[model samples]
Target: MAKQDRAVRTRTALIESAAALFDSEGYELASLSTISERAGVSSGALHFHFTSKAALAEAVGQAAVQRLEGITRPQVDDALQALIDVTHALVRALDDDVVLRAGFGLSDSIERVRVAAGLRDKWQGWVEDSLGQADREGALASEGAAQDAATALVAVTAGLETLGRQDEWWLSHAPLTRFWQLILPRLAEPSRLDVLVASGSKGGAPGL
Candidate 1:
């Protein structure tokens, strides 16, 4: 039991260390030796857990996928509001979690080698599904506005992710708030507009 626990800890540490390195320096530049060193583990141990850097990267991507799944898990009552909440949660994760950030970064960098879908693709699918649900709920302003809104949301969020790489302020709730405020009037039914919070549920709260 103790040996299994130790192995689990070692694997987790390696993944985290690799995530940090991958987040800061692109996947091609982040070396296995450096990741092992950062994790305070030996190269032999790292090899035992993951045979190759690509395998380790794939593991990081899987970890990121789990985190992303948690973010888009749809916990709210309203579909539209759930979409808003997901965006807020995703930005927060991207800002704070190196594994998520690196997972997204690796999605683009190692597209050919990756066996699973990329984070961006997964996010876009979620947005599309959420918008479809909103349309079904009659929350949208028009009949076909869901598709347009999905495209806009994906584009804007992808842009934010890119810009965030340079300045973390891009990942803040302010920009997303402004975006929702501007788009909600057009995307949502007038009746539903007032009920939807653009800045998110956590916005305006102390220390948020």
Candidate 2:
């Protein structure tokens, strides 16, 4: 049991180290030797866990998906509030979590190569689902507006993460908060407007 636990830890370490390098150095530029060295593991051990850099990247992507699931899986009574909350949590996650940043980076970076669908797709799907729920609950001004908001939100999220790679301020609370402030009013019905905050709910997800 101890051996298995240690192996798991070692694998996690390699993934995290690779993610950091991938986040900072780009996937093509981050070498296996550096990843193993950063993880404090032998190259043989890295090879034992992952046969190739692409394989390692695939693992990183999968691990990131798990984290995304953790953020989006919880069911909330107010879906629009839940949407605001998850977006806030996601931006913060991108700001701080190298693994997540790398996962998103890798998704965009490795698009031509064959791999799983990108994390953005998953996030966009969740956004669409949340808005759909809001429409069902009569929180949205109209179904069409909710769809437009979903597209804009996903695009803004992708753009923010891209920009945040160069400047942390893009991922800071103000950008998303301002974005919500502008769009929420147009997207939501008048009665539901009071319930939403562009900055997110105090009762929301992990970041806030």
Candidate 3:
């Protein structure tokens, strides 16, 4: 039991170290030796858990996916508000979590050849579904606006993620709040606009 626990700790440390390295340095530039050293584990232990860099990256991507799934899986009363809250939470996660940052970075990198799908794809799907729900509930201003709204939201958030890689200011909630402030009035019904919080709601989702 102790051995298994120790093994789990070692694997977790390696994944975290690799994520930090991958987040700071591009995947091609991050070396397994450095990851292992950062984790305070031997190269042999890293090799035992992951035979190749691709395998380790795949693990990192999977870990990131799990974190994202947690963020997007909650059932909220207001779908549009849910989308707003999620975007806030996601930006926060991207800014604060190395695993999420590396996962997104790896998802776009050539090293993701072994991974199934990127985090952006998952986020896009969630955005579409959330907006679809909002439209069904008559929360949207018009019938066909969901598609365009989804596209704009995805593109803007993607841009934020990209810009956030260089400047931390882009990752802050201010830009996203401003985005929602400007776009929500156009997308949501006039009656709903007053109730919706562009800065996001505090009740649901602990971090956001």
| Candidate with best TM-score | 3
Candidate with maximal lDDT = 3
* Residues forming the 10-long window of minimal summed lDDT in candidate 2: 109-118
* Residue 136, candidate 2: C-alpha displacement in angstroms: 0.2
Comparison by lDDT, 2 against 3, better one: 3
The candidate 1 region of ten consecutive residues with least summed lDDT is 199-208
**Per-residue C-alpha lDDT of model 3 across residues 74-104, encoded as one tens digit per residue:** 5468999999998899998989999988888
Q: What TM-score does each of the candidates earn? A: 0.94, 0.95, 0.96
lDDT of each: 0.87, 0.87, 0.89
Error of 3 at 101 (Å): 0.8
Report each candidate's C-alpha RMSD, comma-separated, in the order given.
2.4, 1.5, 1.3
| Order of candidate numbers by TM-score, starting with the best | 3, 2, 1
lDDT tens digits, residue span 154-206, model 1: 99987888899999999998999899999999999999987899977653221
After the best TM-score superposition of candidate 3, give how far the Cα of residue 75 lies from its true spot, in angstroms: 5.6
Q: What is the Cα-based lDDT of residue 24 in candidate 3? A: 94
For residues 58-134, what per-residue lDDT tens digits would candidate 2 score against the true structure?
Answer: 98998888888888854457999899989989999898888888888878755532332468788989999999988
Q: Is candidate 1 or candidate 2 better by TM-score?
A: 2
Clashes of each: 0, 0, 0
